[model samples]
Target: MFPPKLATATLFPLTLGLIAHFTIAQATLFIDSEHLPQAKQYDYIVVGAGPGGSVVASRLSQDPNINVLLLEAGPSDEGLLDIQVPYLAFDLEPNTVYDWNYTTTSQPGLGGRNILYPRGRVLGGSTSINLMVWTRSSRDDFDRYAMVSGDDGWSWNAIEPYYRKIEHVVPPVDHHNTTDEIDIGIHGTRGPVNITTANAPYPIDPHVNATSQELGNQYPYNRDMNSGNPLGIGWTQGTYGNGVRSSASSSYIHPFTSRPNLDVLVNATVTRVLRTGHDVETGLPIFSGVEVAQSKTSSVFAINAIKEVILSAGAINTPQLLLLSGIGSSSPLAALGINQTVDLPAVGQRLVDHLVVANQFAMAAPEDDLFEAIRRNETLFNELLVEWERNKQGVMTNGPANHIGWLRVPEDEQGWKEGEDPSSGPTSPHYEFLFAPGFASTVAGTPVPPTGYFMTIFTVLVSPSSSGSVTLASSSPFDPPIIDPAFLNTTFDTQVMRAAIRSAARFVSAHAWDGFVTGQAASFADVNLNSDEQVDAWVRSQASTIWHPTGTASMGRCEDKDSVVDPDLRVRGTKGLRVVDASVLPFIPAAHPQAVVYAFAERAADLIKLGRHLC
Candidate 1:
């Protein structure tokens, strides 16, 4: 259920509008499992409707002759107001029905705490519930992908056009002239997904921008971070326009739902991939179909794909589905009483994610606090909601932060194991800072203070050396996989985080925030930031994932023994099947992955269309 702050009457109309629009105009495009024909087949069967699957499915369906089926394990993203409004993003996760609500294995690094790992169980997947920060990452990140996968097609130069093809820069909700805020020439003006800067100005925005000027080149002002050079403080761009969240579903699927060739089934889970036959030439098992069911006990139905089965169930579920279909390590499958169809030992290995710690401080004045005030005062919150619903303006038009910075630690100063720096290149950011004008806690159920103004600076370790794995808890698809990100497992990762926290402390020390900041608040009040040991301890207790999980089913050279998928994103030792999603990224990008995923999927659609001829 949605929060009580939003009136049901206001939300009912939106729901009714969606229902009427879909059912009357495009009834054939959306199918319920109860009415789904048993022998129905399509040209392509896309497993998940995230950015990867949505792009692939939508692009493929553009050809009227090529029919597409996009399956989502969750409900539709029709009228979920919390998901629609940018400011209410934090309230839609953890234990909500819109989230997967999986918990990680206890980690010794975080005092044996089981972190809450939330994956969106909605139409747009994680993009439907994510914070919506759009970052293209560094140019070197894509070049590194090309290097690892032994394919020049994955290079930054080759993929830059795809980034342009995926973005459609729109006016901010406030309709402020974005003259100096963005670089218009670098962005795509007519793309599917909408991108924008902060809709309204925040009190902390100018201060953060001024700090970049005060700090000189160490913290420089980058007018545009998405220009393939994301290495400085700038306005945070998001996947939104006119105060509405522009998700993969909203951008790629919903607008195209009227297409007669595309059929999307919600609440339909693909239980496992099914091997149909063997290829005549390679003798590799041909996996051209999948078994889907609405529930564990419901009727199981096998759906075949004439062309290919594109797996885009994201990092966690993609690997889990592969293992369930007898395509993982032999020893693990033998223990689970499952047959090993393909002895691919690296199916679920190399899981990577970014760790963020929130550093909070009490604000000097209460009147400047808008977020905390909205959280505490129901009347103000409702008023803001009405303002957003009537006209896309006010704080609800934007997210928690207006500005963000991506910086790298000086190479000579840091401690490196065997002198190997984990970053892709000199331009890649090692850490990031997200400036929030109000109290922000990553931990679930943290209550907002009853009466005080606060600000939080999120210190994120973007370039983590530590890696983890996603393994099967059991053979049953109903059971969730054991997701162990292994956060701060290595000293290198912790060292980077410690540097990020110190950097945040130094950033606020600038004269721009002299009267704005009073002192450290909450957990930081007792701990001394000057002591290295204390800061490390505080990080261990506060660190949590930003929910950008990738690389569980990584891409590599075709002959590479450890790689799960080849350069073409085709599953190794399998024919007529490919894995597209965050799972196929060989290395996690040094920024938010939604924009990267969108670009990767755009390129993947071309590869799928051109087949092996894509150079």
Candidate 2:
């Protein structure tokens, strides 16, 4: 060990050097709030520079008169290799620079364990960290939302234009230059977010396609799942443009940075909304701006909004923000010595997420192993990384998992004997499947296999009867919120999950994988396949989140008292405040929520511009 004086001498200049690097290189993104005026005002203040907030802020800033302030709690996405590469999302899932890294409040449904939930803390939010799977929910799902929210504007037909407006459709996965099989009219050509096939073909692609056919009539290959109905097997469409990850920041925010009216601040955490006064009799607080700081120890300053303050801080943080600002239940805030401004009881209630149970099989085809080709060999891996860095091509261009299937619970298992016409799609589906060609240990964070190649199958329960909440752990915004996504609380959810696991087992054992899969591994070997009791036990042990959480700050009709927001995404009792993220969704959609969240924000920009409930 070095002497005390020598240690200090060795570290002092290095500390200053690191500080100088950030001060000079990232001066624009890292705003020196301490030096700015106490309360610099803008026309609109967008809290959370995620998918939703970025879209709204970008569109609102299009008008030169409307000054928009976009704030993110993390650093910029620039020069972050993991953010640029689509396949590196798993590396940022937990305890990473990009994720907020929140955990559940001891879930009683999952053996009373706290599970880690990753929400993007970076400039693009979860969009930069997500697998970039681009798909929408069922049309009936949105129409049902329209009915529940007491507004027809949310109907699928009404919202379809916004869906097109936010998407720039490209070619398929296997073919780069041609759009032969792609449905042209269903997608847009000039949207910011690029929507295309997960494009790079894998060694196991043909096997999954062949297996889909071998499964007989149950799982047919779908022409295009994005064309309203999603009840079939297909190659996943990802949010990718060329070979790079098409995140919300790269698509919406960075492209429009030249606009003089927009100001984006990274590493700025929002503490609470600044309320100026209250509505006379209603007691609803009139919003002015948001108070922000770099961290708990930093000095908090206000960024005043001239027209509105939008919270797109995602499902977990959005409700936590409302609670800290005295907009939640009276009992909880009063106990914390916080005065209640708007007594909305549902601020942190009715939280939902897509919980999944995964299974892994030992790949018989050792020659086509991703673990061997990418991770095991250093020289080849470094060369691939170099290729990706130089031209943004190679294996790094695709996500870890690609083959996604939306399927109904089998008729025999669910006690529904009749098969409905899928042309218009079933009203909804209970399960979705994601197939991957990699070691389960590497992708799903499980114990590594002793040797050889492996593949994973995840069965996700899309619609669950049970729900959870995100309550304030303490009054301090520095403390993380209580996220309890009470998974498998209901018998139906538990039963459906068991069926989903069984379906995955059957899919892996099918003739399509006869030469590819040698044997099943992990929990599958430990549990008795024939017994329902054993399967339920296995599900409780292996179930994890797909990271799609919503409905904490839900919108509903006035009669729906549990609703925190109104028909037009406004906080029920407050003026000049609105929620335009996944939290505002009344129920969890039947598909991944990123695409839906983008479309919601696109329409929200128009509604906020009109200053009405409907656009």
Summarize candidate 2's per-residue lDDT along 92-141 as a digit string, tens digits.
66777788988887777777767778899999999999888887788878
What's the lDDT of the predicted structure labeled candidate 2? 0.79
Local error of candidate 1 at residue 575 (angstroms)? 0.3
For residues 213-233, could you state the per-residue lDDT of candidate 1 as single tens digits?
999667999999988888989
Identify the candidate with maximal lDDT: 1
- As a whole number from 0 to 100, the lDDT of residue 496 in candidate 1 is 86
Error of 2 at 261 (Å): 0.6
Q: List the pairs of residues colliding in candidate 1.
A: none
Q: What number of clashing residue pairs does each candidate have, in the order they appear?
A: 0, 1
